[model samples]
Target: MAEYMRLRQICLVAPQLAPVIADISAIMGLDVCYRDGNVAKYGLENALLPVDTILLEVVAPFQPGPGTAAGRFIEKTGGRGGYMAIFACEDPDARGAKANAMGVRTANVITHAPYHGVQLHPRDCRAAFIEFNHTDGSDDILGPYPPAGPDWQKSIRKDTTLSLTEVEMQSPEPEGLAAHWGRIIGIPADGPVVKLPNNTFRFVKGDSEIMSGLTFKVVDKAKVLEAAKARGCAVKGDEFLLSGVTFKLTA
Candidate 1:
């Protein structure tokens, strides 16, 4: 059953979704797919990209409550956006059952007529939201989402463009956090990194995004920093702020 789960999407939540979307686009030279309607009933708005058939979405909440989900996330971590790695399942209902059997409760379930998605509590994953969903009336997993407006393929076309590889996680106790996430994702602890079939998750002891969960790919790390600087982006170590979002580069 665990093998049946597949990587689906990566979401980044911000206080203002639009600005973050714009920031990533300018730095990456890609366009975002603005869906026609809200994906969540919680007043969350989004923009998406088809990153190797895995949707990458940036989302934000319109209101407040412990942080409108998106808002709450910003308040908790001070707006350093990270990935909310979603997974595809054979059956969302059965997945929910599995989670319940494991004593994990679904955070929110959405039945938006044509699509069904459930957000697992962040407490379950720590530092991120994990969503599972199966759409109705279509096997077009990435098709329903719009094109990212430009030839995103071109960004990767360059030999220097490294794939925005894996996300890293950081906690007070690196070993404990690694083991905990290993159980959730069915991956084993490999030294400081938890090795999953699709992605490698590294765990460290720190609160910074550079030490914690961050999105990376295979671009000329130095070149990305240089390009970001040319665009008036603020740099802090390897992480850069452009448009209002942060992009961290790693091998």
Candidate 2:
């Protein structure tokens, strides 16, 4: 079985970039590393931020045409959920082949010298788009993540958000959803949780299949909430709904 090294990043899609990108940067105290021009092929614009070694990305469609997958996601969830859960692996092709053999749809394969990736179809995975990638000679978690653009690691700011600990996937049937994802990702479901090496995928009961929320290990939860509340996000307890997804801060 192929093993995922770590939870590489969480990708979120928003209807618009402005307030969504602004709120995430201000509230979470994360630095915007790069505005990737690479996604132009998909008719989308994106911003990448380093949340420690793990990344937080938000993509919005520049063109609302057939090429915009992010636009499709926003329309599907009514702009109310997470989009993709990406993982870093030693060899993504092995995992991609495994998923392929299981009848899962392999969506895309991107390679640029040292970096290579395979994206799995969301319809087959059932909850979120699953992507796996590897940097040719680098196994370090803090090494180059080519998808985030160069100079991405230089943007790491740990004074506020420390780590992305959990990614929440929601569905009407949590157990079954987790099981389906488990078969695809090669991770066993712990009841409703898909336990990974560094973090966990939490399958929660909800109306539809979507990546719903993220749990962040933070330095100041109060400060984050205050910033989020000021930005007009729907705050409930320590969590807030922003960019069509939930942000849960924990110390």
TM-score to true structure, per model: 0.76, 0.95
Tens digits of per-residue lDDT for model 2 on 1-251? 33556788888888778778899898998889888787888888889889988889999998664458888887777887878888888789898899999889899998887888899998888877899888865587777777777788899999999989998889999999998888777887878988988888899999888888899999999988999989998889999998878899899
Candidate 2: where are CA atoms >4 Å away?
1-3, 65-67
C-alpha displacement of 46 in model 2, angstroms?
0.4
The stretch of ten residues in a row with the least summed lDDT in candidate 2 is 1-10
Residue runs of model 1 more than 4 Å from their true location after superposition = 63-67, 81-83, 112-115, 135-162, 208-213, 236-238, 241-246
Candidate 1 CA-lDDT value = 0.61
Residue-pair clashes, model 2: 0
Clashing pairs in 2: none
CA lDDT for candidate 2:
0.85
